[model samples]
Target chain A: MFSPLIDELINALRILPGVGPKSAQRMALHLLERDKPGAAKLASSLQQAIEHVGRCKLCRTLTEQDICATCTNPQRDSRLLCVVETPADVLAIEQAGNYSGRYFVLLGHLSPIDGIGPEDIGIDVLLERLQNEHIEELILATNPTIEGEATAHYLAEQAKRLEVRVSRIAHGVPLGGELEYIDGGTLAHAFNSRQGL
Target chain B: MFSPLIDELINALRILPGVGPKSAQRMALHLLERDKPGAAKLASSLQQAIEHVGRCKLCRTLTEQDICATCTNPQRDSRLLCVVETPADVLAIEQAGNYSGRYFVLLGHLSPIDGIGPEDIGIDVLLERLQNEHIEELILATNPTIEGEATAHYLAEQAKRLEVRVSRIAHGVPLGGELEYIDGGTLAHAFNSRQGL
Candidate 1:
């Protein structure tokens, strides 16, 4: 074992996702041995981000300001709001370069067993936006899982009362995916949601 | 894409070993979103390590004090000195729980092409220890690679002049490693170094 500080650094590094004890040790030693300047930069960056970054008031996406860039951008379509599970999903949709709409990040799905519910994921704020804002279409871009489906259905029902059109993202064999390799659930969903040419 | 601060944080996270851009983004967001306290801890730990940790004066291993605990411990055998390429290797040998001798960290192996000479890896200090410290034996625990072998051979030649016994760690099929899965080079080395048991 190394000194106390080295061990502490290793333990602290394990807080990051997917890093194990061995990896933490390697990282600690690497920074100490070779990249002290990089380590210092990373430390300052983390401190600055933690001190400044907060959830956007509009869409609940993470940002340094009260409202995220995506929510405040004039070029983005205000009349269309896409709902997603996390901020990372918003990045994915943005990177796809097809959506011009604003986003409403749920942060997580409705899992009753885990005690995650409508209010927990800021569904009230979403409903308030639906009633107040002139959002014409609400796109459900949550993952194609049972919990995602349930959350989407619940949000759709809520949006319906507010007269906002709701649509779920299509589920099928992924682009370039062979049908033979596709799972039964996705294949069945694709068949059920098939549209005529 | 996220804000400038978020982007900076993500880029900074990439300095850690094995973290690519995607993983860096994930780590950045993960720390910002779910574990700000953990992030703070990591940042502070990194800062503390960089500020306080320095090489051991005797063994050249990283430690806060002038001498590392291993080098300072009186229980360890002073007459036997194990020379290794890096401090991490010292930790590895210590974890094996067999070594009770002092250590001399080379920090890196000898490489003429890269312009790394004997002095670069503290060969002069090692020779001084062999001469003045009454070291009876020198264990060359450097890696089994070409560079490691070159370094060991160089150190062995030096120690021979000082009248200190020199030995390299065994190179063969590792414990629990099947012969079929072992590489040809290692297998060949194992055959060449076969013991008379």
Candidate 2:
């Protein structure tokens, strides 16, 4: 609203998820008034990231190099592969500090209504990787939403055809979750998947 | 966390007001995965804004040129000058579509504990402008906080010395503000400032 450059900056900032017009304006003014140097650094960093970062050839996760850190790390178990919807999911799993397997990021789930199918989510590429790699177990770690479930089921069929053991990540009450607040679907899943303790 | 470039980008993004580590990570991943082109545009726009936008010489609001649009607009009431704390305040006032006077930005309010004083807020520059301009009335539109009140009182003294009429923006119940939820200070002000029907 102040100048063309500022207007452009505000519009560009709207690309960020959850940032609306008012928030974008606040961010733009904040950068201009308080942190010009930081804004410049952010600009350069954005350009560098956009130019350098791309999908890892093997896992489809974002990386500056041909392969991502997890994909190339020798310490991770190559015998087990985790399939996830996006790079964010990979970060979440890694942050938990429990999973130590290689990952294959689908980037999106299969949604036939939206015209996103197996080829759309790079299923062929995943199938090719499974065939070439020594991965004996495939863990479907996609979200528990309907699209994620459909994608997992389809991938499981492909893994079975290739004679690879496939497992879906458990759907149950979260560790800190209260049963009273847990959704019906999750509670049902927790009950159905009950194991002797 | 993924790579050096990604890490740098995330750090740079954290410069935005109110964005924490998790939000920065989410924004970075979203740009990388969903909107690379938009991210590039934002980068370029940020650089452009940093290089071009600066404080308007007259009004102290953000501008690409020597003078801001508000300062240059002949249609505005130049005889009535409004003093504010920041460019964001100017934007907020303009958005209200009621005020038509010129503006002088202090950029900050008086905070003695923080070592902020008249010079720090460009009080001398404002005084000089008042001396040279034909402004007959000075409106103290600073915020209602303690610091804002101190700044406004100080500026009022200066305006009185300059032989210009000084007025503080009224603090009353905001439009559509419910009395039941309004703070005691604001309710008292509203009652004190009650006008004829």
- The digit string of per-residue lDDT tens for model 2 on A98-171 reads 98899999999999999998998999999998899888999999999999999999999999999999999988
| Each model's DockQ score | 0.91, 0.86
* Chain B, per-candidate TM-score: 0.98, 0.95
lDDT of 1 by residue, B1-197 (tens): 89989999999989999999999999998998899999999999999999999999999999998899988899999999999998889989989999899999999999999999999999998888787888989999999999999999999999998889999999899999999999999999999988888
Best by lDDT: 1
Model 2 per-residue lDDT at A161: 99
Model 1 chain A — which ten-residue stretch has the worst lDDT? Answer: A64-73
User: Candidate 2: misplaced stretches above 4 Å?
Assistant: none
What's the distance in Å from true for residue A114, model 2? 1.7
Candidate lDDT values, in order: 0.94, 0.93
Once superposed on the true structure, which residue ranges of model 1 sit more than 4 Å away at CA?
Answer: none
Report the number of the highest-DockQ candidate.
Answer: 1
The per-prediction CA RMSD against the true structure, in angstroms, equals 0.8, 1.3
Give lDDT tens digits, candidate 2, residues B79-133: 9999999988998999999988899999999999999989999999999988998
Worst 10 residues of 1 chain B by lDDT: B125-134
